[model samples]
Target: MPLKLYLLPILTLFIMTFSSCSKKDSGSAVKPTEEGLKVSLTNVTEASYTAAAGSTYTFQAAVTSKLPSSGVNITVKAVTDPGGVNIPQNAVAPSTSGAIAITLIGLEPLRTVLVTVVITSTSNPDNTITKTFWITNKAE
Candidate 1:
């Protein structure tokens, strides 16, 4: 055999040996944290009013944060089962100490209005949270 043939086999063996020896270490499992951020809806109320046919009602929501006060934004939405309610166009950030208030409009009579407050950290976008409550309209 020519010397070139032996050289090719030796090179191939050397490459294979190094490649087989290379290994990746799998990382260990991450433990869950004991401390967690908490958000609460405080002093939430709707204006005392009656809704008539073809009329609109406004509901208000107030939210407070029990964790860090910075970088928290609140968005309020009103949802019906049929999905015909209109939500707010923009999200509002807490002006003081993670406190925000949102108002929803165009509510119908004899319908359940679901108010959802979504609290998100602008600093850490992935750390988003939400809370929901419902208000019912009765015929006057």
Candidate 2:
């Protein structure tokens, strides 16, 4: 028999062995939960800022969740990229039945403010979700 005939059979066996080992080493994959938790920014209203060079403003955010009846705990924060904004220190933990309100104070004029609401499940502390909203001051 020619060397080419022996070469083909040896190559075929080598390929099959490598493929089978790869599949087994990959291990079992976990499917994501279809009915897992989710969070949404319900409302952002009563937002106003002063036109003066130095002034104060108040902003509010409403957060809601679709967790179980027991509800999920969340931490809502107001963040700004430009800086010099005051977000409340207290963190809110909203219930499933009702939404939570977060207040931000002392925002500067002609600046953009980014508000972020982060929701974390008390049941699963490792799981966390976040949503953001942008507010721009009207030109004076």
Candidate 3:
């Protein structure tokens, strides 16, 4: 009889403890979100680039980051080089803050070539941005 009485109190206490506990709304907790880098072609408007055959065009790009001083790495590549397009620097580390210069030379007359430029934060690999520019080499 006494054991039953003790067990009843203990069970009640356990139930009460659990009943008092409540779950918190996970949505209410603030989370830090990363805003990736922003990239744009400085010289060209509307991301369009054109150059005559046997001519060279310079594509100047600028990058901005939410986190300052986070060194950035840039990659400039022609989607398909048909033996006429030459990119001297495929990879570059900007000496200035997010200033990149990509020069494309059309050795011979060719069609439109898609050039892709990708910028990634050295500090955060996931923070990256890609921009594509179309280069057309028209016969002069």
Candidate 4:
């Protein structure tokens, strides 16, 4: 066989391998324009909270988003007693000042509940954040 014939096949294979391995500009692809929601508890300074048993504990939170939101959805769950916590409102419109009220009443005394609060931005439901805290009912 001629040397040029062998070189031609090898050169073709080398060129094909290098061309397929070339870097691609994947960064230029279009991405979804979604922003995350920000939630902050304004009244609760600590991660955990305590309140008198049989009394309603009211707290304020601030939620903001860069994009316009239809409203905010607040879901609360009591790890200790699912039926013990009472929520007056779960869905609320976005506040201009980004302030919302979260009220909870502990029905049992000397009981601790692990409260999970999930705040979801209606504009982008996927962009949600969760806040988990413990709440204890104390004797009045």
Put down candidate 1 lDDT per residue, 66-118, tens digits, no spaces.
Answer: 44435566677777745656644455555445445555555566776666767
Model 4 Cα shift for residue 36 (angstroms): 1.1
Report the Cα lDDT for residue 93, model 2.
Answer: 49
Each candidate structure's TM-score, on Cα atoms with residue i matched to residue i, is: 0.53, 0.48, 0.58, 0.58
Per-residue accuracy of model 4 over 8-72 as CA lDDT, tens digit each? 89999999999999999878856465667778776554467655455455677676556334666
Best by lDDT: 3
Q: Clashes per prediction?
A: 0, 0, 0, 0
* Cα shift from native, residue 88, model 2 (Å): 4.1
Judged by whole-model lDDT over C-alpha atoms, candidate 1 comes out at 0.56
User: What is the overall TM-score of model 4 with all chains considered together?
Assistant: 0.58
**What lDDT does candidate 1 reach at residue 100?**
53
Residues 1-140 of candidate 3 have per-residue lDDT tens digits of 89987998899999999988978677885534567777778655536665545456676877665543656777777654455455444455653476777776543456666677777777667777888767766775
lDDT of 2 by residue, 40-114 (tens): 443343233223233333333333445555556766555555774655546554556445555555455667666
* Best model per TM-score: 4
Off by over 4 Å in 3: 1-35, 45-49, 81-90, 94-96
Measured on C-alpha atoms, candidate 2 has an lDDT of 0.55
- Relative to the unseen true structure, what is the C-alpha lDDT of residue 41 in candidate 2, on a scale of 0 to 100? 45
Candidate 1, which segments miss by more than 4 Å at Cα?
1-36, 43-69, 82-90, 94-96
Error of 3 at 16 (Å): 25
The alpha-carbon deviation from the true structure for residue 4 of candidate 3, after best TM-score superposition, in angstroms, is 25
